[model samples]
Each structure stands twice: as C-alpha cells, then as structure tokens.
Target: MTMESAKLPDGPMSGLVASAVEYMVDAGQRNVLFLDIMRKRGDQYREHVAQTAPHVLQYAAELVIDGRKLAEPVNYALVRIVPPEGVEIDKNRRPFVVVDPRAGHGPGIGGFKADSEIGVAMKAGHPCYFIGFLPDPMPGQTIERIARAEAIFIEKVISLHPDADGKPCVIGNCQAGWAVMILASLRPELFGPLIIAGAPLAYWAGVHGKYPMRYSGGLLGGSWLTALTSDLGAGKFDGAWLVQNFENQNPSNTLWTKQYNVYSKVDTEADRYLEFERWWGGHVNLNAEEIQFIVDELFVGNNLAAGKIEMSDGRKVDLRNIRSPIVVFCSEGDNITPPQQALHWIPECYADVDEIRAYGQTIVYTVHQTVGHLGIFVSGGVAKKEHAEFSSNIDLIDILPPGLYEATFEAKGEETASSDLVVGHWVMRCEARTLDDIRAMGGNSPEDERRFATAKRVSEINLTAYQKLVQPWVKAMATPQMAEWAHKMHPLRLQYELFSSENPYMATVKSLAEKAAEERKPVSQDNPFLAFQEQMSKQIVHALDSWRDSQEAMSEALFLGIYGSPALQAAVGIDPKSTPSARREMPPEHRAMLEKRISELRSRIEDGGLREAALRALLYIGSARGMVDERSIEALRQIRDEQGGARMTLPEFKMLVREQFFILLLDQGAALAAIPNMLPDDLNVRREAFRAMRRVLSASEDITGEREKRLRQIAGMFGDAVEEGDRESNVAPFDSKAKAS
Candidate 1:
C-alpha cells in the first residue's frame, strides 16, 4: 500500500481515537438525558409533596411532641404506643419488643404501618411495644447505654406480661440486630427467641463475586476514613453518610428510577414514596466511639465471628453463649447481607451441626431467593408472608431439636395440610443441612481470612495515627454550627431539601400538578415514554452491574495477592484449626445432666443392631410420611392398640423414631431398601418426611460419602427388584418346580 493511502483521511490511530470519542459522547448523552428526566421528575415530586403537605402535616401534627415538654432523658424509659380507639391490647397475650435499626435512618419502620411486624404480633393476640428513638441521639449517648436501656425495657415488658411463658420476643432489624445480640449476651435472661433480620454476623464470609460491599472498607484505605468522618461531624458521625453508601449500592434506583417511579405514576405511588422517605431521610447520629467499635470489632476486624470481641468489663460477646434460639433471616440476592454473612457464623463458631444441637441452641434460617436488603423489613408483601410465618411459628422453632435447618415456605390452598402450614396457608418445613452444605455458599478461605486480618492491623495503625495527630485539631475546629451545616448539606439530606419552600417555582407547579391529577388526566400504563423509561432504567442497571463485577474482580485479586504471598501466609495462619470443645461454663448439675444424656444416646446407638436400626429408620420415615395420610395414621393407631395401648406422646414418639433414623443412616446398606416408599407421594407428608430425614442425618456423627453411596446402592437394588418382578420370563420355570414338588 502507498504511504498516501495509509496516512490519509481517517487514519488507523485516528479511527481508534474517533471510536473512543464516539462511545464517550453516546454515554454522556444518555446520562444527560437520564439526568434531565430525573430533574423534571424531582420537580414533579416536590410539587406533589407540596400539594399533600397540608394533610400530611395535619396527620403528623397529631403525634407531635413539644420539645420543651419532653420527658426525662433516659434511653430506657417505660414507653407505650397508645393503641388507637377500638384497638385494645390483649392483656393475656405474650409481649413483643420491636427494635428498629438506627443505621442511617430514623425509627418506626418496624411499625411504620398497620400491616407490619407490630401489627402481626398484635393480631396474634400479643401485646406489642416498639423501641423507637428521637431523630437525634442524646449528647454522649453510647451503645453500651443503649444496650442497658433495652434490657430495662425488656424487664418492664416482662413485668407487664406476667403470664407469658418467655420474656418479650425481641425483633432487631439491621444495625439493631447486633445491638440485640449484645443485649442478649449481657442479660440472657431478659430475652426470648431472638429474631435478627438482614443481619451480618459472619461479616468476613461471602461468595467471591456476590458480595462487593465488604471490600469497600479495605479498598478505601481501612477505618481511617471512618475516624475522619466522625471527627468532621464534631465527634458524632452523621448517619446520612451510611445512608448514602446504601444509595450508591444501587445507583439507578436511587438516582433515577426512585423519582421517576413517582413522576410516571404520580397518582398511585406518591403516598408510598413519601411514607418511605419520611423514615429514609430522617438520619440519626452515632457516637464516634460506637462507630469505631463497630468498624474495628465487627466489620473490618471480623472479631465477632472469631469469638474475640469483648466489652469494657472484658466479657466476651460470644454469640454462641446466648441460650435462646436464634432465627436468622437473610436473602440470597441481598448484596448488603448475603446468606453467607448471616449463616456462616454457626460453622465458624462451632465445629458441626451436632455441636450446635448439643448446646441446645436452635438456629433456623430462611434464605429468600431474590428479596433485596430493605425488603426483609419494608415490603408489605414480604412482611405479611415471612414475618407473619416467623411470628406464628416461634413456638415451633423454640422446641425444634438442635441442628442446622433451612426453612422453606410453599403456598398451599387447602386447610387440611401439614402442621408446618400456617394461617396464610404456606407450608414451612425445616430441611437438615450439613457443614459442607453451608460451606458451599461461603467463599471463605485461608487467603481471604489473612487479608481481613491484615486489614484489621492496618485499621488499628490508621486509627492510632489519627487519634494521636489529627483528631484534636478536627474536634477543636468543628463547631456544632459546622456539624449541623454538614448534616443539612449532605447529598442524602438534599432529598428532603427539594420539597421544601426553598424552590421558587414550587407553589404554582404544585397547584397545577394536583389539579391535573385530580382531573383524571394521568400517564397511562401503555404510554410510550413509560415503557422507554423502564427500558432505559434497565440499561443503567446493567451498567451498574458491570461496575460491580469489575470492583469484585479487583477485590478478589487483591485479597489473593496479599494473603497468598509466602511472607503474609507465614505471618498469619488462616487455615481453620480443629473443632473447639463445647464445654461452656454452666451450672454443675446441668452440665452433668447434659453429659449423661449424650452418653446414653451413644450407648443406645452402639447396642442397637444394624437390623434394628434399619427397621427403626424405616419406621421413622413411615411415621413422618404417615402424618400426611389417613391410612398411615390408621395403621399407626392399629399398631398402638395392638402393642398394648399407646405409651409415648406424639412428640416423644417422633423423637424415638428420629433416633432410629440417625442410627440407620450411620450404617447404610441394602437393608435400608427393605422399606419401600420412604418418601410418600403425598406432597405435604413427603416434604415433611424429607425434612425429618434430613434432621436425623444432620444429627448423626458418622455420616460421610460412604453413607451416601450405600443409600444409592440400596435404591438401585430396589429398582432392580421392581424390574425383576415386572419381567414375565420365569412362569414356565415356576410351573416345572410345582410339578416336581
């Protein structure tokens, strides 16, 4: 080729540069379009708010308290939510305490509406009390103080509901989840079943590409920024910063669609958007010390999962120490708190599921497939379903034998279904799970742990340097006026600013928009713009997804590179050590009794013959599946009558059967094949039996791949036997045998 041809118009280098420029211009244009639409939507949102301000103000005014007339400033004071007229508290019912999270948001979310956790408890004939705080914390309020106040509140709730079997059932959401755990550990006697929703305990455990939020602290140079932020806030960190982080997790929803949703469907979605904003925009503050402790001891340090976190008096905050059943609610799709973060703590803190059971600690976790973080608490559909089931079944969970179980819910229309089916007609069963099963979801490894440990060390150095050199200057310069200004000017705070009278054109547009909506002129569902907006929103979402993926890759690479190095690996040992003993200090009598029970269980298993174990396992499966069938129940009744009139209660009988199931699972073989239809065809009973079988398998110690192989072999034998019977080739042979006889 000639030089002229190669160097002429649109040359090779120019072509590449031009392509880059074109791509940038296209992206810029799309962003500008999105911003313009969002701004217009923002204006519309403000207008709608202005129109509804009067009615909302009136409703809010009804509950307003005069600042000068506030009660004594103790965090733990007896408080009651005055039930509305015609709604009476059930004096005889158990009491419930709903603790709302102060993480970047105000209180009342636990009871934000009528169909909520509080509402469900109320409908279930339980006395309900909500633990909410003011929009601001008291000066110098510490987390320890809050914990003490909660304990006091529980005492009052207990005294009020004297006849209840257990103390008030505490429901803690998000940040409050940890707070509740702390309270429970310090004063275990003041609590009942503890429900922690969307909480992260095993903060260091998560899947490789699924949880990117955990890497943000290390990526941002550790906890120094947290200290700097707190110092900037005049020793009280603004919670809006935390809220802003949450918003950034999903930019499209927070930046564009959140407002667009109201503009496009202004008439229908306006109330919901405003109601949620009322809670979301009201940010609270945490003491600098509290934030630092959370960062060093929980998030960056991952000390809580390691059983190293200690209080001022040096009492360890061992989650395993709490005697109450812990019901962990998390979601598979929650990037903020994934299933691994919520669940891996069990295996990390203990050796096996049996160890957990041996401690008499019942843990039941329900992992939703696709609900995001806030949906665990906010979505009415979710609250009505999941929360409702949990509240109704606390008794069942409380009594369930110790083991790792995955709680599942299935919708049913019939009333005569399994006992796991609750009022809403959803059948819930606890499936047995193994450590390997739990490990499959966790991305934890030696390298990841080492990197986290390094992060912890770096955080300590950063914190010390700031405290020694920079903190005094920051506190001296940051006045209360400056802190207040900072809070108001935060980007997260501006969500409330636009709706205020600060906008000049708000009034006229407000009237016009309200009139337009009232006149029945609104955007149709089929409107081209609405469809276009959704499509564009999805594209933005995809862009955010790409960004998240890139960040996750870098994080994983950094972790592996830092921890996988020979020097670092030698410095920090990350491989998990041998399982720890479960000999927790307790009353001598109780300990001895527990040991004796374990010994007896072992003795029984050893003495029982393999045939007896197999037969018992088959019978147990029959009992489980039998609960679903009328005929099976009849057979059980017949056996009971013939075997000298029933002796054990149903629960006791079920327990006996389960013991046999585990014994059989320990020695798996063709003998197990003798029992046919172990899992019945009836959907309800089959599910129950499957769950029961899992419980037995999880409780056993000798379970391994050999047991699984034997089960397969047994299944194969049964299949072969069925096939042989089906074939018709041996009739002449049978006839010849009969003639010879």
Candidate 2:
C-alpha cells in the first residue's frame, strides 16, 4: 500500500545501484521499527489478558441468569446490553436477543462496536439482550443443555417485554445459528422474526472445489479425530484447535496476507491488529459431550437439515415446525457458510414452495455479493443496511403471507420512514423468488450428497470403534495438569506466550522497541528494491496458495474415489449412482385432513361476514403482486388501523390473513366469487372498503401491469361498488392525509 510515482526515467547505470543502497537503508529501519512494535504489542497483549479473563465484551452487561445454578449447568449467562449514550432504546419494541457463536472465540462481537447486530437493533429502538458464555464449559455440559439454556434466556427476554408488539426477534451468528433454529423449532411460541447469519445449516452441502470444509470429516477419517482430541483434553476440548482449523481454511491470510498487511503498515495497523487478535486468542473450551454431538450429529451426520435430530426427551426436531418468519443473511465470499449451507435447509424441509405456504411460513433471504464469513455479522456496512432494515421492518415480516421471497436493499435518497419522519437512506423491497432460486445456489448435487452420506455412516463406525478401543486408554492417561499443559501448548495459544513479557529472556525488548520508534525511517514508495521485495512477496504467497489448492484437489479426488465407489456405497447402504426419488401420495390421515379442510372452506365460502370479505380481498391483492414490499405493508397497516368497521385483535387478524391466502391458493375462482359476501348492499360502505383496497394496492408511488388488471378484476367482483366517476379518478396511493385517516 505505497504511493505511486512517475515512471523511472532512463538514467545512468550507477544511479540504479545508489537507489538500491537507499532502499536497503530504509528497509533496515522498517525492520527495526516492526520489531519494536511487536514488543509493544506483546506488552499490550499481556495487559489485555490480565484485565480481561474468561470473556471479552466491548459493551457492559449485567447478568440475569447464571446457567450454573440451573438443574443442568452450562457456562452460559443471559445478560442485558446497557446501550451507551446517544442510542435510543424502546422497551415497548420487540426485544432483540443476539447469540454469538461459541466456536472457539469469546462472546461480544455482535455488539463489540457501535455498528453491529445489537447496535443496529438498539438503534432502531429495540431492547437488546445477549447470550454469552464463560471460557470453560460446565462439566458434562452438552450442546442440548446449551440449546435449552438459550431458549430459557429468550423466554426471560420475552417475559420482560410482554407489552412489546411481538415476540423477541432472535439473531444467531455463525455456529450459533443452528442452536437458534433448534430453539425456534422446539419453542416456536416464544420467538418472532429470526435472523441467522453465516451459519451452516446444510452441513453436507457445497459445490465440489468451492466448499471443502464438509470434505475434511471424510479426509480426516471422520469424527474419531474429535473423540481423540476431546479425550486428550480430559473431557474438555480446547477451543484453540477449532480456531486453528478456521485459520487453516485460508493459509494465505493466516500466513502471508494478514501479517504482511500489518508489517507493511505497522505504524497505523497495530491497534486494529491487536483488537482482532484479542478476540481470536481468547479461546473457550467445550466439553467432550458437546464436541462429540456437534461432530456426530451436525457437521458429520448432517441430520439437522434432514429433520432427524432428536432431543434427549425423544422429541424430534423438525425445521418445518418453526412457525416464525426467517430472514437469512449470507455472503457469496463466505467460504465457511456459503449461501448453499445457509439456505439449503429450506428445500430440505419442504418439497416445494406450496408446502412452505401450506404450513404458513415466511422465509426471506439476501445474498451479499462479496463479504467473508465474519463480515456478514461484523461488517459495519452490513449492520447499517441489512440488520438495520431487518429491525425496522421485522413486524411487517410477521404479517406477510406464507411464501418465499428475496429481500433487496436499494439505496434511497432522503425520504421519511413510516413513523416519526426520520430520513432514511435505504428502501427494502421484497422480490418474488422461488425454491429453484435457492436450489441453484445450493449446488443441488445429489452425487456429492451421496458421498457425504457415506462419510456419515463411516464416521459412525469409526466413532464406535474409537470409543470402545482408543478412547478409554486416552482418557486414563489424561489428567487435569496434562489437559492444562496441552491447552497452553496449542500453537494458537503458544503464539501469545512467545511474545508475552512474562517470559524472562525478552524483558529488555520493550525499552529497545520504544527507543527505536524515535529513529524510524520509512522507505520511498517507488524505490526499485522495494518494488522487487513486493514482487517476491506476491510470488511466495501465490506459490503457497497454489500448493494449498493442489492439496485440496488431491484430497477431494481421493474422497470421491473412495466414497463414490460401488463397494463403499454398498457398505453405506446406497447405490453408487444416485436414482430419482419416487414421489409418494399423501398419507391417508394427512389426506383426510386436507380434504376435510377443503370441504369446510368450500361449504363456508359464501357464509362469512363482510369483514372476512375485506380480508380475503386484501389478501388476494397481495398475492397477485407476487411480492410484498414495506410500502405496501405500511399502507395495509394504516388501512387496518383506520377502518370504520368491526375491529379484530392483531393475532385474530393474522390468522385471517393466513387462512384467506390459503383459500385463494386452494381455488382462486372460488375465493374471488366470495368477495361479495365481504361487502354489504350499502353502496357507500362498499366504496370505502374498495378505497382501502385501492390504497393498499397502490402503496408504492404507482401500481401497474398485472396488479392493475387484478384491481380491475376485483372491482368488477364488487359489482356496482365502482362508479363511473370513481373509475375515471383512482384514489391517490400515498397522500399523507388519506393515509392518516
């Protein structure tokens, strides 16, 4: 990152040698400066460690529940975020509960800065709570216990906000996302709109050569490695190993790019580098039971996506049981949890979009073009746009009829929000998206899935063998002191100790570095030798990247060759070649329920009050558009609020919206035929209801095409409700005074 200079002029040969000599002199100074900064960083690192043990959270918090006191103790606590000054918080708004991943790192990245998940929610006037864990897991604490504790924490948040508009809006980052979904499926009554960012839901999904984390299980001989590691730690696996695996995913960054960036700009980059390293180095530990379950059931088995995961009480966890609306945020640049892993669960849970709609589920997702895994949660721009928009419009997401949609954030010029006239910089619009949209992104490779299925079976065999053979011996040899020593000796942890002033040999380096700062000399941007050094550095990084790529390719080839063979497929109880699945007819009981419901709807098609008629008509308009935007919903909300007819509770209205949408889906003609039942003989009253429909349909600046045609069709269904003069001048959509009434 050096400044550019004019092209080198053709000059005398000796001049080149002189410039090289100056470049060497500058290089020597930078080397000395870098060493000094490193020593200072070591001192800072030691001080940081001394002050912040067990956990590091930027925002101050007061614990509400200590899981250790529970019947099944975990090293987790539910805390309330105390928003700093200048942030407005509304206790009446839906509570936001953010859970950071327990995957190797300390908690609080969700709100470590002013522009974060919690930060965005609080900015939108939400009461924010966080689920943070201590450094060590409680003895024998399992992922199931943690999941239950998280649910309890959410329940407490919901109890504190009983007067809020809806249930708590839950956010789960990375590995925490699956736990969030588990809680939602188990206790769907306690949650609201869910936001799961960069979490791997479909663990066995990925296009070949694109995502290789799934392949590591088979390559490493399955979950035995997890068992061995856990046994070595004396029933508590050090999380630094997890952190090292993540770093190994991209060697260029871990070994070259990140360090080079710091070294090249050590003068300004030290503070930022140290800040990130603090979180990276503060590793937590998981109990043997927890890691084993994670690997056996989730990462290796991929059972969550299959709805085959079972709790200790024998209750099966099904994603389709989750009644809350879900908004998934993923990035194409995220190698860890690509869009495939983040969103493929939708297709796994539902055979088609109609099934999703039949179950009354709303799912919306946005795929960022380029942002790494952590960037999905920690990037300020993502927080400002996607997270902010989600908080402000989550209530609207709840009212949306069952369907799949892709939400897009469009940059806006100065415009007022629905309330308080706050100038907004983004307009979020929901676009019509189908299941195929997700399938394409999911890489839809049945062949790859077959290989993973083999791996899962093989892992089960290996894990059982290890537990019966090697595990007992390993556990016998493992002691508390040995475990502690192993954790300290981990390469990820050892780096900190190597630089720490706690070591007696390097005590004088601090004073030496501080004094060297005074003699700092930076190299010229255009020095010939500096250019040569940068070129060589790039070449080395490229070589390492190439080597990593070749290794992965070889591993993948071996994995496919082994697991894709006919013999292994037979061993795993599968055909080597994938066959098309035959669709079965609906079960008799389920079919009976569907038939009875359809018969009931048909019988009552013409028998409801005008209130039903209005709701049915409104739902029709929303469905015809193939998408719903914030503007449309805001208009509908105002209309519902201002109607002069019989009023209904919010929950009652929600049920009506869902039922009418389904009735329309059942038979569009029958649903339209029943619109007159919703209107009375009084012409003026009919006109007002139609006017409400007109306003809701035209919530945007304008409405045209199929929506306009549908409006005319509905107007014709109203018979004489539309007068000749009314047809000539349609109601203006966004007139403030009209909306206010």
Candidate 3:
C-alpha cells in the first residue's frame, strides 16, 4: 500500500485513525487559540453591549410604560408601519399585514431592512402594517388566543383600509406559519391570500435522511422535558431553550462560524451581523401550555396531517377548511423544515389530489433545489426572485381553479427575451402535482405511521398526568414574582440587561466602543487566511450535516427494524392511516365503495369519446410536455373553440373542449401533427393556454412537478413541430426553428 493508504486503512478503522490524528493536531492548536479569540470576542461583545446600553435602557422603560398602558387592553394594538410623510390612501388598493415569526426569536425580520417583505408590500403601494409584540408575553397567552387576536388585528387593518380588499393578505414566517394556518382555518372569511415561508406543517413527514429535528421528540421520550423546563422556570417556558434547540441543530454555525465570521469581517459585516443578532438573540418566552401544545399536537402527534387538531372551543382545525389560496415556500436544502415537512401536509391531509379539488382548496407549493431554511425568508436574493415573483403573481395564483400546483420560477436565458407584458424580471410556470409524488417524500409506511401514533399516545398520557397531578402545584409556585425573576436571569434576556445601564462596566467602554465601531474595518476578502477560514467553516457545516444525516438514518433503521418486525408490529398496534395495515383493515362497505369508485373512473376513462378523449389526452400530454408559453396553449384553445359550439354553456364548452383535446393527443400520428398545425402563429396563444392549464391544474385533483415538466415538453413538441428536409419548401409554413430543433 502507498504511504497515504498506509496512514488510512479501509472501513471503520480508517475513519478512526484519520479522526484521531486530525484531532490530535488541530485540537491542541484549537484549544490554545480558541480561548484567546473567545476572550477577545467576549470583550468586543461587552464593548458593543456598552454602546447599546442607552437604547436598552430606553427600551426597558418603554416596555414598562406600555405594559402599564395596556393593563386593561387585552390583545389589541394599532400597529403603524410607515407613517405617511404625505402619502394618501388609494381607495382601490389593498392592504398588507406582515406577521414576523416569534419562533424563539424577537420580531421585525419581515421588515428588518428597507428591501424586505414590508418594503415589497409598501412598494406595491399596499397599506402595510406590521404585527409585532413586546419581548415579554402577556400574563396568560395561549396560541389559540394569539390566533384570535391576529384575526382581530386583520379586521382592524380592513377597517382602516375601507376601500381596499375586504381582508388583508397575511404573511407568516416559521412558527407563525402554522399560526396563520390556524387563523385562516378558524376565520377563513377574514383572510385574503395566505403566505407561509419555511413553515413546518406535516412535521412527521420528511426525506429519509434530512430534518431530524422532528425525530428528537420521539427519541428523547416526547415533550416531557418541555413541561419539566416550564415547571422549573415556574410557569413561563424560556424561549432561550427553543433558540438553543435551533442552534443545536446547526452546531458548526452556532458554535463557531457565525460569531467568527462577524469578527473576521467586522468592518462590513458588523452592521448586518448585529442587526440579525438583535433579532436572533432576542428570544421570547412561551407559556408552558403553549410549548407543550406545540410539541405534543404538532410535532409529536402530527395531528395537523391527521386533521385531529382542535381550537380552544374544541372546534377542529382542519387544513382543508381554509378557503384562501395557500402558498408554501420550501427548499430541498432546508434542514430545519424540508420541502416534505412543508409541502407534504396537503397530500397527507387529503386522501388524493381529487379530494383536494372536491374541497375547493387552492394549495400551491414551490420547491427550490437548494436553499437553507433561513434563506427562504432572509436571503435578499431569494426575496428578490421567489418572493418578488409570488408577489407579482398573487392575483394569478388566487384566480387559479381549486387544486394543487407546484409553482416554478425559471430565469430567462440570453436566448429568451423579456416581453413587455411580463412584470417580474424572471418568468415562471405553475403546474400540477400528484399524491404519489408527495408520498415519495416519507411518513407513508405502515410502521412509520404506527411509531408516530405511539408517540402521540405517550404524549397524551404524559401531558394528562402532568396537568392532573402536578400542574396545580407548579402554577401555584409560578407566581408573578418568580416569573419576573426568571425573565431577568434568562441568558438571552441577560444579554439585553447587561448591555443596558444595569452593567457597572457599561459607562467605561461606551465611548471607546462607539469610536471603534466608527473606525471598524473588516478583513480583506482576498486575505490568504480568509479563504482557509471559509473553507474550514464549510467543511464543519458539511460534517455536521453528514453526522445529522447518519444519525437520522440509523434511528430510522433501528425504529423500523425493531418496531416493524412481525412480533413487535402485532404487539404495538397500527394506526388506521398506516399503509398496507390500514388498507387491509378497511371496512367491507368502505372497501366496496373505494373499489366501485375506482371502477367508475376506469370506466369513464375507457368510454371517453373522441372530443372528450382528446381533451383528456391533451391535458395529460400537455402535462407531460413542457407547454409553458403562449403558442402551444393557443393551439389547444383554438382547437377547443373551433370544435366548441356557440350555444354550449361554459361548463359544456369546457367539457367538450377537454374531450376533443384528449382525443387529439391519444391518436398517435394525425392528432399530434394536427394539434400543432392548427395552432396560431402568435406565441401569445400558447402562453394563454399555459395559463389556462395552470388554472385547470390548480383545480385539478392531483398533479406534480415532474409530470408538469413532461407535459410542457409535449406542448413544446407542437411548437417544435418540424418537417424533415421540407423546411426550404415551407409547405407547412409553421416552421419554427427554435421549437422544432
């Protein structure tokens, strides 16, 4: 073996040997340098703290005044975002309310900068309002109470903008995502378009080896620790705990790179880092009840997908009950909330896509190939592109027929020129998604469902026992005095406190820090060590991610192997939603109904006539082909209009056209060539058809991104229609080189 090969053997031993040597070399250096850097960083941190002391003092004073002022107000506020320098309300314009997530963090991320969510809405000339809260919670605030308060808040926004749309478009981020969902479900009439970013919904469902946060509750014996922590805190669950959990998920950044990057790039990165840290470090508390409810019902039980979640009044919080168009933004690279956790909730809640159509719920989801969880909301690049596209196309998304669609944002290449009609810099396509496509993500297996069910049961039993026997004593001891003391001592809260006038050292460093900040200059990007630092940072992140994945895979294997075995399966019992197991247990009558329904659909497929068949086939083919633009759609429409009779009603016309379109695609030779031949020269027609297809897709029962891309290609085939060697003759005269080639 080579020297290198000798140094590193194969299998487990190789990893051990490599790790030991690396650890010995770097660990010693890291131990020495890490302490000195940390001490300096801590000094700098305290110095910055000293500078911000006055602001913290002022904020604390304002909080005291506000708390006293709102002694009798309950949950109500007149939130003014941008006070008019001199701008008047346009009666025709709508209003916007952006609710920032209080997910173990303070508010204002939605409007942290001038070019943020609030900025976009204001730029659109909408009357924008921000729903923010004090760092401290109300004496006894529950999530349900917060949802009701949000509804009331939106109602007030509507009242302010009298001539605008009746309801305001509410945007929720992270934890607030499910809150808005609950609000929309409870008060559907009060909401317009609902936007959820980086939201975790179907928590139980995720990719095989990604997003292991949801698995922790089960592994750690459910949410008993949440209750224990709350009890220890004397009632209020420390939001710092939640923030710490988030930090733990990404150890490399939390432990090293985040602060290191700031120090290394202090000049330019200081302001941005401090701005983000202001929010990131501003952790807020939740009631013990609130945290328990979230962990037990949403995370462990996965009740949202099961449609078992209830409101304070015991009313069910069914996701399908929400009438407004729901927009879900997720990413493949998001480790906290993967696309499966964010988007799969729809399919999990509904039996199939058709059921979604039957319920008249408009659900649209977009999956970015690679963007981290925070990037979904905080990345200016994503905000400019994805958010901008969604903002511009809100009306289009709203008008789509009730169904499920995957919204895709595609940047136009140099070959593609921008049209006068396209508002956004980028172009986009909305296509249907299928149930099977969603199921491919996870949480479908019989064993997986059963394990989750067991978790739910354990949580219920544990929570019930805690509430029955221990809650009274805990509450009795959790007096106002204790809560206040706990808040003052909290590490997250202490950061603010230490930076305020309360610190004896603050006055001394305050002036020096100011001058230092003003004179601050960051390390050069071209510095040799800078590249090494970044490389090291990325390597650490990758190692953490790999470790996380391996842990998840091992956990899943153990759970499935142990609980999924025949003996354990028989002993543990299975959930009704569990596949294979549930399918086997279906009642005779329900089974008959399902079989009959399948047979009926099959019969309808077989008996479909030429026109109907053509339309169906076209829908299928158009779905398979990437028929995104105006040309292909116009051809489909023209065929429909020509074949459609003037006397036909809208429904009849649609049916007839759809039928004919299907038949055209089903016929191999003539129909395929004929469909393209009949299409008008104007690409606008294809574009409209593409839009129509999206609208239809929205109302479709089940469709998927993969299938939609395929359909676009099919439509493109028509646009691509070429006669071999007959191009010079111009016999067809429909010779479009771009399409054909």
Each model's TM-score, in the order given?
Answer: 0.71, 0.91, 0.68
Whole-model lDDT for model 1 versus the true structure? 0.62
- Top TM-score model: 2
Which residue segments of model 3 deviate by more than 4 Å? 1-78, 83-91, 412-418, 468-485, 491-741
Candidate 3 per-residue lDDT, tens place, 1-741, comes to 677665555898776565555544443333333333333334444454344121111011112112213433332233656533543444546666777776776666777655567655655566677666654566677777777777767877777776563357788889889888988888898887888999999887765555668667766667777787788777778888778778777776776678667555443465566556655666666777778789888888777756678876889887777877798998888988888789877766677765665455678888888888878887778877787776666655554455677787667555442232245566666777777776666654555666666655656666777778987787677777877787667675564555554466555455545554554434444544446667887887788767766777887666555545555445446543445322112236645765665554443444433333335434554445333332233333444465456544333553354344334333445444445544545555544444344333332112346654544544454353322332222212122322222
lDDT of 3 at 171: 84
What C-alpha lDDT, on a 0 to 100 scale, does residue 549 get in candidate 3? 65
How does residue 167 of candidate 2 score in lDDT? 84
lDDT of each: 0.62, 0.79, 0.61
Candidate 2 local lDDT, 397-503, one digit each (tens)? 77778889899877764343343222245777777788899977746456777788888889888988999998889989999899889877888766677776776
How many clashes would you count in candidate 2? 1
Winning model by lDDT: 2
- Per-prediction backbone clash count: 0, 1, 54
The positional error of residue 514 in candidate 1, measured at the CA in angstroms, is: 4.1
Compose the digit string of candidate 1's lDDT tens values, residues 20-92: 5544543344333333333444554355334412111111112222221233243323345555555566675
